[model samples]
Target chain A: MSLPPPAARPRRAPLALRVAAHEDLGGGLRWLTLAAPDVAAAAEPGQFAHVRCGGGLGPDGALGTRRAYSLADADPDRGTVSLLYRVWGRGSVWLSQRRPGEVLDVLAPLGTPFRLDPHRTPVFVAGGTGVAPFIFLARRARQKGLRPLAFVGARTAAELAGGEFLAAAGAEVAVATDDGTAGFAGTVVDLVVRALEETAAAGGLAGPSPALYACGPHAMMAALAAACAAHGWPLQVSLETPMACGIGICLSCTVPGPRGPGFYRRCCVEGPVFDAREVAWE
Target chain B: MSDLTTRLGPLTLRNPVLLASGTAGFGRELAEYLDLAGLGGIIVKGTSPSPWYGNPGPRTVETPSGLINSIGLENPGLRHFLEEDLPWLRTQGATVIVNVVGRTVEEYAAVAEGLAGADGVAALELNISCPNVKAGGIQFGHDPRLAAEVTRAVKAACGRPLFVKLSPNAPDVPAVAEAVLEAGADGLSLINTYLALAIDVARLRPVLPSVFGGLSGPAIKPLALRWVWEAHARFRVPIIGMGGIREWSDAAEFLLAGAQAVAVGTASFTEPRTAAFVVEGLRKWLDERGFATVGEVVGLAHRAIDGEEAVPLGQS
Candidate 1:
């Protein structure tokens, strides 16, 4: 059977954008805050922004590629979104060099924001630079006055830029490192298990089971999912897939989801966020 | 007052500029960023039987002036595209040239037969040049007989204008182009992405799960131009040249090299309306020079090279 026709997905609305702030968060990571006049004033916690870099041309007026990043901070009231990215590719390098007065072409409110039930405690786990989304999620969770546990994993102490923010949110914060360069010598999954066990041991789980939300390396998420299964915990995971069109047409950023066998879903349109159990972890 | 149009057998394009298949996604996503109406035509992503899961993860990596992608011919089966994607594209208000792909000669025929009556699909481009997929891809592209066979099959199955998108990996691109043209292809789309790969240092593994991937971008432009120019020198088939066209000068180069049209793939990722910009640039240059038409520039660059001459119009 010839494949079915493509779904005519909704076009992303154009955004009126301006760079609000630019800061180097140290360790090759820089954060940019952008204001979009057109987006819904209320930006959700788990959503991401599609960033367009200017002067993609290499000193010759050549074209540049576009990239998507999770919004680490969003104030719908202020019509601004914060983007945190690590210097890895040319896109990131160009982004890091961007100055404060510069303007960028961007589309926002992409991907479903992380979904969490207020009644269920949100347990956030992050690995390396994947911690960006969770930091925003932590803030939103706290703003709702729901204190969730956050386990942030980094290779070394210098990499955990959001540790203080997570701690100040009134959420129990645990740090882990594989090389023992900073906190416990292990992955974030280990730290999450330890924290959850302590909470359960203190008889804190008599109510609704804590919901797990994790974002990081595929290996790290797979491990966290296993830990969730072991503890009978329900989890939501945010994924980072290669995507050129945030609108889902390119079919470049697809991950196996709960849909069907070998059936894939777009990380940009369907979600950059999904229930952990729904994701088919390999 | 300008002759911006060109003919590829029975098909007539307003100008000699086309969007490459697999690079431009049906013209819907990029419509917002650029003017789709300005292009000669648009090529949708590769289509196949049933939905293809494509490659695992790490499908793209940046290498100098190019990008390597092992996206494994990912697309919803043709049925979904005819039903869901085509109608929406009609609403996007642009003429769409559908790019079709299949795993077998029979599969290609079936797709052509299926799209025969579809409304809004202005033309059909047969994509036999994809490099990453294990089946079908590069197979039909690498050999003249197979490429001609597929082209002939698809041409028999569909009445719409047919374009055979040629692969750059083949030894003699002109031979492959000629085979398909004789087999009934309406025109030729030259030089899809080159087969390439990248490595992940930390994981000590190939960056893409597929191990090998197709390289596209500015890096492959020169190579693509050479193939297009070679085919143009050898055949009269209207060639849609594309590789790493980012601006007007690049498009002009392709036009001068004998391409009736050109496609902008990787540049769209960087600037969505780049194809339109190229088209406009072509118009501006032609108007300033008072050439009165685009054809005057086509194949003009080859004239300067003393040794190279247009092959006799009917060389078999």
Candidate 2:
């Protein structure tokens, strides 16, 4: 049967309203705060908002596509949210150019969110822009009175958008930079490994492993996964793909996983998040 | 009532409208925006014998009125398809034309061999036109002999109909089309992306990592129609016309210009529902014109032209 004539779907409650946008946290990266009116009723960590960067296309009448960015901050009761992104190309550059008072089209509370382990200790691993989602996850962890560790990596200290926010959320935050312009001189994995060694030496009361939640470049995620595997730590990773339609329709966001014999999953629908063990990293 | 259905050789399409590979992916994403089942058929993204990593960062760039893509034919490979994507696609209820690209005649044969018995796979559209890869693409497409060899190999390996997708970059597209037809290709999809490029001013670098990418969208429509008309005139095999077809009017031009079917590409990047929209528009057009069938319009241009020595229309 032919699909019902194309109609706009408006079933979702607005989780956030665009409150402000400006040059912040350094070059090519912009911070936009959205006010989520409904989140106060019920907001969960690990959920994201899909924003339609209004100027996504060029001047010659191209369709402006939408992108799914991590919600950096959210207040369920206050009905506010935040997002941080780097202006990589046209779509992102268009998003950064938006001004305050202009409501960007947004689809919120998407993807399989970060699931907190009730018994296991939580560890947050993020790389640069990948750090966006962890801010909320860390905040939610603290709200539930859970202590989490956040290890962040960037090219330098200036690129770290919400380091203070993570610390305020009570995460034992560690920083890593490719250039020795920040806390750790190497990668976040190096900091993580060093932290593990120190914890091991102290005969830590926390178990030998931590439940790892990571989001970053495939290389960083894979490295973190391998590190967690070596130490026998369970890990979850938020993967990225070039998504055309943020809905399940465009299989363009397909990712190879180790689940079934021919395991493939859509990042838009199945998850922007998955258990690291189940994902076939590529 | 108009008969929107048409035939490309033995394969019967519900209408003249079809979705181009790569641009449409599977029909699922587009189905959300428009009714996919209402269209003629769906040609999936280029598949291969093995999963390909494609190219690195900077694969796609938006040019003025068009797009340059160097996606390098990134796909999950054949094994993943036979086991995963195909089964799911079959449930959608459209003619599933699997677009396959090969690095060698043998690999093309191997992939065609595998798909020969695969369920839900109606035909194989050999993508000999991809410009991103250094191996087994434009090389075969530009040269008539290699195009014939690859077509013959795939034809021998698969019992299903074969549609050789030709590149516009070649000087003599009609010659290449004829060779493929002689080699047993049942049909043809004319005009894959033309070789093109874009520059990044901010980084002072090439917009795409490959430096040169294949151009598609409205920019290449006229050229694609020329090739389709020329190839259709020279060869008996049915031609699937594409490139820069964004709307119903463009699709109508291809049909009146003698295309057996029309594939909507680049437009899908901007408007996911463009294919279904075109299909609906074509059906209404036929009904209003009081034509009984879409086939009546195919090669209709040949009848009207004062001269017919395989000349391209809309040219001085």
Candidate 3:
């Protein structure tokens, strides 16, 4: 399925906006809805927002590093953008404490957005808060009249996010959890692999090979990359790294190329999303 | 109207605010949010003779008021940069300071020589302070002899004014400063990132893969100011001060501390328009303070205290 592009807002400097809403998503997770028309108007699937906590990440809210988070959803008409993140460090913790109406500085809709040709099926594999871009992808796919299949996993059922959106998008939703408190009792990657095999065996789909879209721990993404390679599947992976600025200026999120290229690439620019083949999973 | 203009050796900048090397990443990255040509200069990422991939992952971590990073001077070789990046940089309309680093003195000279006649390049900034690499970087800055040798070699190859950036970790920073000045350094930029490390309490291992990394940001400003003050108090050379400069006051502090100009480094990562903001803010500050030129503030602090401000402390 093919859909029209989102409303275009010419790229400008990051804007400061007020938080319209905030919600806790199970343990250590947060959902922040920001009142940023510019960001929402320009957001594309798989692109992320560089979020700066109003207070620093240090004790007493000292100015710590500004961190990046993937956009979970963006409503241009509503003038809003949303992000889903897990509290891993001071930055996230500070973000979690933000209240509605509090101003937040953000650089948005950055990096190469994930590409899913309408001719191919998009199989989204996510772990924990990695569900961020997957949810956006699912919703966007639905808008295009295509239904993607998503494998959502977490430590337990309590930690899952956005599976309902996958179902609403008409996707075949598969859930897994480490503690077997969800649909499947294993890793989401295994569930995705089995599902792909079943679809292929049933000879039940039309057009190009199914494309795999995944965002999770490096280990999980690396595993998915290898699985996709072994089965000759097209895979696009979203990456996460400790970064200062989400823009390309900071070399903080640099990584070597997949095949030992001599120089480094800024993950914030060259990608927060990359073809699995371009990544040096090793 | 306040004039932000200041001179570094032969180059006259429109403002005293320079985008420190490595922070601007070739100038185009920050250009997305700013007018690149508006800055006094952009010290491009430190380049070597050949490409360097830098350290393995987990290269940076955030500490209180500072960011610790070990990027290992990852950059393309001189030839590739000249062929690809320099032309685009030329179009940015900013004074381009090509910062060169190497494991050997000849490598530095070769890279400097490569940019000598390059269109759009204004000068060369020799980075002898990177702590991640093994062979040379900080080693050259730590010894007066090695610092002098690198300066002389690059000077011999390039006719452009040479600015050797000094490391705060030098064994004798003032001595290193004097040696480089004596060896024909047209100007200097001080101080580079300080050697620091962090421990992952849970894992009981060093945070960065390199074991130790350069500590930058507001945390290192005091040390940088001290070094710049010390070097300026003793030498006649123009010094560009930088270390954790995040605001106009920080840049102004450096100027009053004896620096002719200031470079915004890690602060650029924190805010893309920091250098430009500092420039604008400095103009407001100087105008309100009734100063005529940025040069008037250079070495002003040295004139304030009695001649006894220099109780020399051992260099890091």
What share of the reference contacts survives in each candidate? 0.24, 0.09, 0.52
**Candidate chain B TM-scores, in order:** 0.93, 0.94, 0.95
Query: Per-residue lDDT for B1-316 in model 2, tens only?
Result: 7888888887888888888888776666666556556778889888889987666654666666567778778777888878877876766666889998889988888889989989888788998989988897878999999999999999899979889999888878878888998899998898799899889888998977799988877878888888777776666468888988877888988987778899987666545667877988887777777667888778777766746454334321
Candidate 3 reaches a DockQ of 0.42
Model 3, residue B81: C-alpha shift (Å): 2.1
lDDT of 2 at A105: 58
Query: Which 10 consecutive positions of candidate 2 chain B have the poorest summed lDDT?
Result: B307-316
Ranking by DockQ: 3, 1, 2
The whole-model lDDT of each prediction reads 0.78, 0.77, 0.83
Q: Pick the candidate with the highest TM-score.
A: 3
Model 3 Cα lDDT, one tens digit per residue, A56-94? 643335565677889888888999988888888767777
Tens-place lDDT digits, model 1, residues A40-81: 365677788877764454435333456888888776677777
Model 1 residue B159 CA deviation in Å: 2.2
Give the docking tier of candidate 3. Answer: acceptable
Docking class of 1: acceptable
> TM-score for all predictions?
0.87, 0.76, 0.94
How many Å off is the CA of A143 in candidate 3? 1.5
Model 3 Cα displacement at B243 (Å)? 0.6
For model 1, what is the error of residue B266's alpha carbon versus the real structure, in angstroms, after optimal superposition? 1.3
Enumerate the candidates' DockQ scores in order. 0.27, 0.15, 0.42
